[model samples]
Target: MPEPTYRQILYASRSEAGIDVDHILQQSRHNNAVDGITGLLWHDGDHFVQVIEGPESSIAATYARIAIDPRHHDVTILSDRPVGAREFGYWSMERAGKSMQDGAVMLARLERRLTNAPETVRQAFTAATKR
Candidate 1:
């Protein structure tokens, strides 16, 4: 059989005030599962940094929707590339909380699992938290 192909897209955005993270997670988890996508999302009150992985077509469609969502602005694509494997294979759309402990754990896990992640992704995480 041919090797499996996966695409990873990392993006950052500014979320509107009063946005509900739980609601977003619930909707995303359902939609992503149906679309065969997996990824992680981190929100720090004002900003969001997400990493999505899946088939090329699915990733493209999902990101296009996100880019136009009225809930966020200043959407920026940090990285988009083909990958040999899924870094976040288990979760459909997990959310990393805004606590220091949560941030540390998420960063460590990403470094360990996706050692080849681009510097832009790391920088996005930092920028999200600092905002």
Candidate 2:
């Protein structure tokens, strides 16, 4: 097979107290759109599970920024690998959370997104959303 052109990073983190998730989502959408990145960000009240995928350079730069962001702590990487194509290709940054009014719908969509993801990545999201 040909080499993968995209890099994907799946990670989980503990959200810092009083951090504005709305602001973070807004900022991420803008940045990811400009940088040609796409992914899902599932943030419960106290934790985060995300899957970011894009060009190799963009993914590297984006992950670098995320690594130093103050909104979250203990940013543990669940998976880092390359893919031949984008998996979460529909959104620049889609936000999912149990706090939403349409949470069941959001979770169903999230399950679809993780349908082909690694078991560990899927489990991380499952655990976080359940909390």
Candidate with maximal TM-score: 1
Overall lDDT per candidate, in order of appearance: 0.81, 0.83
Number of clashes found in candidate 2: 0
Q: How far off is residue 16 in model 1, in Å?
A: 0.6
Off by over 4 Å in 2: 1-4, 99-127
All candidates: TM-score: 0.84, 0.79
- Model 1 spans with C-alpha error above 4 angstroms: 100-102, 109-124
Error of 1 at 65 (Å): 0.6
Instruction: For candidate 1, list the clashing residue pairs, or say none.
Output: none
Write out the backbone clash pairs for model 2.
Answer: none
Candidate 1 lDDT: 0.81
Candidate number achieving the greatest lDDT relative to the actual structure: 2
lDDT of 1 by residue, 25-128 (tens): 99899999999999988888899888899999999999998899888998987667788889888899988855855676775654443356578766665676
